[model samples]
Structure formats: C-alpha cells, structure tokens
Target: MEKLKESISSVLPVTGIVFLLCFTISPVPNDLLMGFVLGAVMLILGMGLFTLGTDLAMTPIGNHVGSAVTKSRSVWMIVLVSLLVGVFITMSEPDLQVLAEQVPGIPNMTLILAVAVGVGFFLVVAMLRMLLRIKLSHLLIAVYLFVFLLARFVPREFLSVAFDSGGVTTGPMTVPFIMALGVGVAAIRSDSNAENDSFGLVALCSAGPIIAVLVLGIVYGDVAGTYVPVAMPQIADSKELWLLFLTAFPKYLKEVALALCPILVFFLLFQVTKLHLPKGELIKICVGLVYTYVGLVLFLTGVNVGFMPVGSFIGQLIGGMSHNWIIIPIGMVIGYFLVAAEPAVHVLNRQVYTITAGSIPQKALSTSLSIGVSISVGLAMLRVLTGLPILYLLVPGYLLAGVLTFFSPPLFTAIAFDSGGVASGPMTATFLLPLAMGTCSGVGGNVVVDAFGVVAMVAMTPLITIQLLGIYHKYRFRPEEVQEEEAASEDEDGGDIITF
Candidate 1:
C-alpha cells in the first residue's frame, strides 16, 4: 500500500497538470461533461495499472535475463542476444509507435522497423563496451561527432525527427528492463570495476535510434516529405469516450505482448539451460508480469484516448489565444513538473544517488532535469511560433552538448546522454507532442518543420544541463581539496595559524 502511494504521488503531478491544461485550456464542450468524466476515469486506471506492471513484471524479467546472459562465457552469443533483445523490445515501444504514426514522410512500419534495428545494433555495441571496459565518454565523443558530420548531409526535415528518435525510442517499457539487463550483465563479470559498466546501457541504447534515423535520411535522400497532421478528436458523449478507450486497449495489449515475448523466450531458454529461480520467486515474478500487462493496458488506453487529444487541444487553444506569449511560461512550468512524474526518472535518480553514496542527491538530479526540460519546452514553443529549421537549434545544441562531454566527468556524460532519452518518456509523447501539433495546426505552421522537434528539444536540453551540473560539482569539489592542501603546506612550514 505504501509503495503504491509512492508510485501514485510520483505520477499524479504530471497527470494533474495534463488534466488542468486540458480543462483550463482545451475545455470540452459543456454538453460533453460525461465524456470528460469517462476519459478521466480511464486515464487514471490505466496509468496506475501500467506503473504496477512495470514494477512487477517487466523489470524483473529483464534483470533475470540480463544476469543469466552474463554467466555465459561466450561473448559473441551475449552480444548477439542482447542486440536482438534491444531491437525487439524497442519495436514494441508504445511511445515509439506514437512517434512513428506522427512522422509524415516515412512509412510507419518502415520507420518502426528501422529504429528497432538501430536500437538492437547499438545495444550490442553498448553491451560489448561494458564487457571490454571501454571508456563511455570517448566512445560518445567519437559517435556523436560522426553523427554531426552525417547531419550535414541528411535532409533538414528528417534531422529533428532523427534526433527525436533517439529520445523517444527509450520509453517506459524499455528503460527499467533494459537498465536491469545492464546491471544483470555487469554483475556477472569477475572484474573489480563491474559497477561502472552497468551505468552505460541506456546511453548506448540511445545512440541506436539516432544513427538509424540519420542513415534513414541518407537513404531517403531528398524525397518529397509529407507531414502527417494530427486530427483532434472531439468527445461528443460518454459512450464515445468509452468506445475510444476500448479501441485503444487491445492495440496496446497486443503491443506489450509483442514487446514481452522475446524476453520471455530468452528467460525460458535460460531456465532450460543454466539459471533457475526458486519456485516461489518465479511465481512472484509471474504475478508481477500479470500486473505489468494490466498496468500497461490501462496506461496506454488513458494516454491515447484521453490525454493525447487534450494535449493537442490545449496547445491549439493557447497558441490561438490573444495572449499566445503565455504558452512559453506555461510550457516551462509543465515541463518542470512533468519530468518528476516519469517512473524511469525516479529509478534513474534513485540509482544515481545510491551509487554516488549520497554525494549526488535525488533532489539535485530532479531539479537539474526539470530546469533542463523547462528550457527545452520554452524553446519548442518558440520554434512553433517562428518556423525555424530544427537544425538551426539542434546543430548548435548538439555542438554545445558534445563539447561538454570532454569537460564533464565520464559518468556525468553518460547520465546526461541517458537522461535525454529518460526525459522524453510517455508524458512527452502523450502530452507535449499533442501540444506542439495543436499549436502548429492553429498557427498554420508546417507540423513537420515546426512542431516535430519538441521531443528532440526536450531530449537535448538535459544533456547540456545535467553535464553542466556535473561540471559544477567537479569544480565545486576541487576548491575544498585545494584549501585542505594549502593548510597542510602551512603546517609543514611551521607557520602560525591565521585567524580572521
């Protein structure tokens, strides 16, 4: 019960914010109050169920598989299996599904498959890096530089979506399980530095989508692009809302099942060979899996049926208002609070604080991430208002973020990059994307050119801010060391202590 409350508290603020934005900004027709109530009930139920499911079902399964894989001596098999797992899980991500649907130029299935393959290939590389003890920062610098160079040639329209892909691909279902897999694999190594290896899986998984999408742009090569304009669905009655909820429920259930099957098969293979959990623990995990399925079904139904339209509606209302300038501050506030609601963000923050022995607190991480996202949202609103090419912003943003990679601690760099994916979770897909689409529609702007990159921007800002915080912590720690050294020197010189 306590644990459930904690989860609800973490999630409610963002959910509340979405509700407020919809009611205050979007305002369903007075006649449609029943529809609104129905949607709200469905949204709450879905979110709660999904949270429980991830905690119980998805995370443990991933962790168990990860640990089992690590016990094997065959490096090639580990790499191949991990790669395939990454691709398969990513292919079933609900947020990525939403993103693919929105992307106008590319076929949804093609983009989905391409992004999955990208994540798979990169997951292998990430696992291999952990196994080989490669320095994450150096690899990030080299890869991102290559990506920047590729960005120069890829069509400008695809650039934002490409970068955005990196962010969206690592969604709710992927983060906990994948991170657990990294921990499980890292734990198997006999090396004294195994802990360090666990930190980079999310970072590596993030790279796959970016590289895949960039390669995609190169392949498409200036083909005429079509932007899929998102239509705002009106709720006429309670029956309509219930029908929408029912329609979305089955789709996500199928998607989650597809996502879970690969891992389950791997788990079964592990059971047949070397690893086995106690029967009781195994049953517990089975229960968790059931919970996970129920939770995801509800969560997806709520977001797709109730939340997405509301987000789009609010954005259109705000952007179309006489006081359109308010959109910037409003977005910033929502962005700040919205990140706190992400379940994965909680996991990441808790892990970072624990690993650092409380040297880095959760509050500090939350504050930094919130601030970073707020700025990104403000910038996104600006992009919608003025049709700036996303590259103009993204090129400089990545350049700055890449430059920071050299200056910050290696772990900070990894965390920053990972946070890019973490920050743009389900809320960004359900709410922020809709908001951008709504505003873009209202303003008569090109949706692809203006609105498409909000997710990219949300993803990018965290890289800069979190790394900057790392830089600050690095410098801040230095002064104390220098002061202690000066005092020691005075003692050696037999000088009298100076009093203020």
Candidate 2:
C-alpha cells in the first residue's frame, strides 16, 4: 500500500503536466489523450508492482549471487560469472531495445549484443575494483577520459547515440540487480568504505555501453541513421483503445518473459548448486519474479503503446509554434517532474538512504536529481532549437564532473555517478526522447545529432548535482565530526584481504 502510494505520487505530477499541456498549448488528438490517460494509470500500477518485485526477487538474487561467487575464493569463477551476468542482464534491458529500434542503419540484435558485451566487460572491471579497493574517482576519471578520446575517432552521427546508450543501459531492469550485486560483493568486507564501494558498479556499467557504441560508430564509419517517427494509433472507440493495450500485452509479455528468463535461469543455477535455502524463501522469490514479470509487461506496454506517440506529437506541435523557445522551459519543467516517474529512481534513492544510514535524505537526493535532469532537458532543447553540437555540452559537463570527484566525499562521488545512470530510465527513453525527436522534427533540425543525446545529457548532469549534494553533505558536518569520520575510514583502509 505504501509502495502503491509512492508510485501514484511519482506518476501523477507527470500525468498532470501532460494533460495540462494537451488542453492548453499542445492539444493532442482525442485518441492520443485517451491513450495517455490509460498509460498513466498503468504506469502507476506497473511501477508499484515492479518496485515491490525488485525488493523481493531481484535484490535477493543479486545478493545471493554476489555473496556465493565471492565466497568461492576463485578469481576465475568470479570474473567469468560477472561477465556472463552483465551480458545477459544488459541484453534483456527493455530500454536498450527501445533505443535500438529508434536508431537506424544498425540491426537491433547487433547493437544489443555489442552493448551487452561492453557492459559485461565493465562489470568485470567493477568487480575487480571492489576487490582491489581502487578509488572510484580516479578510475572514473580514467574510464571517461578514455571514452572521450575514443569519441574523437567515431562519426558525428553516432556520437549522441553512443552516449545515450550509457544512460538507457542502466534502466529499471538493471539498476536494482546491479546495485544489489555491488552490496553483496561488498558484504564480505567489514569496513567503513564498504558502503561507499557498494555503489559505482552502475557507474562503470553505464560507461561500458558508451564505449561499445562509440567503437561500433568508428567501425561502421558514418553510417547515417535517421530517426523513425512513431505513427500515432487511430482509435475510433473505447473498445479500440482497450484492444490496443490488450494486443500489446502479448508482445510485452513475450519480451518481459524473455528478459526475466535469463535472470531466472541464473538464479536457479545458484539455488541448485550453492544457495540451498529453505523452500519457503524460494516460494517468496518465485512470487516476486511473477510480480516483476507482470509489472514490466504492463509498464512496457503502456509506455511504448500509449505514452510514446503522444510524446512525439506534443513535441512536434510545440516545436512548430512561432514562439518555439517555449519548448526549452517546457522541456525543463517536464524533465523535472519526469524523473520522479522513473521506477529505478525509487530503488536508487532507497538504497542511497539505506547505505548512508539515512544521513542523506531521500527527499534531498530526489530534488537534486530533479534539478539536474531539468537542466539537462533544457540543454537538450537548446540543441534541438539551435543545432548545437553534443560535444559542446558533453565535454565540459563531464570534465566538471571529473573535477568535482576530487573534492566531494568518496561516498558522495560514488552515489553521484550511480545517480547519473539511475536518473535516465524508461521515462526518458519512452517520453523524453520522443519529446526531443518530435521537437527536432518540427524545428527542421538534424534529429539524429540534436535529439539523440537527450538521454546522454540526462545521464551526465546528475553526476554534478548529486556530488554537489555530496559537497553540501561534506560541509554540513562539523569539522571535528568530519575529521573523526575521515580518521575512522583511514584506520580501516588496510583491515583485511579476501579477494577472489
């Protein structure tokens, strides 16, 4: 009941904003409006179920896998398992599928496999970092620096898509599992830094897709991919609307089933071989999996069938206006409220609150993410309006994030990077990306170059704001308390060695 209320609260603001826009400046077609209303309801219900499902099933599965693998004390097994887990989880992410469909010139499977491999490789790197106790800041600096340098060799058209890959890769499907995996891996260590270390797996995993897509760009060499516009559904009556959602159910049901299958098989492998838990617990996890599957199917169906076309139409309508500059402020406002609608966001916020022992309030972190995404959407709109190069914004935004890593507390730095990935979940892909694409179409801009990077911009800004939150957190403490906490962390720095 509490979770349902939270989901309702998260989704209502965005629904209100869309309806308000429809009635006023951007009057959507009646059919589109009707779809949006139905989609919003499904979104709320699906999100509630999904969040509940993750808590019961995904988190426990990740924890079990991480703990069991680490306990084996075999580096080879850990690396191999981590790699496979990353690939399968990423391959199953629905948001990545959404992104792949929008991108032209590349086969969906090719892009999907490429992104999966990248995430798998990076997950290995993240695991190693935990065992080695490497500083998250320094590693992030190097990884991103390498990413940008590689970007120089890729084609301009592919740059935004490549960057956007990073964001979508860490959507609702991946964040909960990955973050819990980090916690499970960190559980072996009894130290102050363990909590801080539990973060940053998502951070590195996010980068993996960027590098992978950029490399794909370089190899493909300026293959021009065009934005494929979504055709609005024609609904003559309420029955058709009902049928529209009803028909989508099978497709998403198949998709969600396939997505969850790999994870389920992986868990069962562990259950039979290692995690011989009580039958009662197994029943609970099975129940949770059912919820996860149903919730995702409903959620994906709503977003893809209902929200997407409406988003594109709204953007097109608004961008075609004489005072098109309004799109910037409007985008900013939508982006602000939209973050709250993301399912993975609630997961991230709750984990951050738990890991930090509630030192960082969920409300504060949520606000920072909102502010960051608001700025990102505004910038994304500016690019659509003026044909600004993505690099003009990305290079500086990342550099600043890199610089801030040095000053912010390590926990904050970790949380900040994780926040970047979490902020740009399904809502960004289904709605905001379409919103940007629609605006670009209306404004006669290069949709591929201008609108494609909205997800990337969404992914980048929270790295700064959350760290700024961290900096604020750093200063909020008294000098003595800060010194004491720092001293305590340092003392446990060399506590033990149990690497696998």
- Best-fitting candidate, measured by TM-score? 2
* Pairs that clash in candidate 2: none
Best by lDDT: 2
RMSD of each: 5.8, 2.6
lDDT of 2 by residue, 199-245 (tens): 99999999999999999888888865566798899999999999999
- Looking at model 2, residue 86 earns an lDDT score of 91
TM-scores for candidates 1 onward, in order: 0.89, 0.97
Stretches of candidate 2 exceeding 4 Å from the true structure: 487-500
lDDT for every model? 0.76, 0.90
Residue 228 in candidate 2, Cα distance off native in Å: 1.9
Per residue, candidate 1 scores C-alpha lDDT tens digits across 1-500 of: 54456556655676677567656756655433443445545555555565666666666777778877777778878888888788888988888998988888688888898899988998888888887777777787788788888888888778878888888888877887887788788778775446545776787788788889889989987536676555556667657656766776778889878877776787778777767778987787778777767766666666666667667767887878877878888889889987776656766775676556677767877889999999999999999988888878877888898889766665677778888888898778877888888888888888876888898899889989998988887677765663464356345532111110
Residue 424 of candidate 1: its Cα lDDT? 90
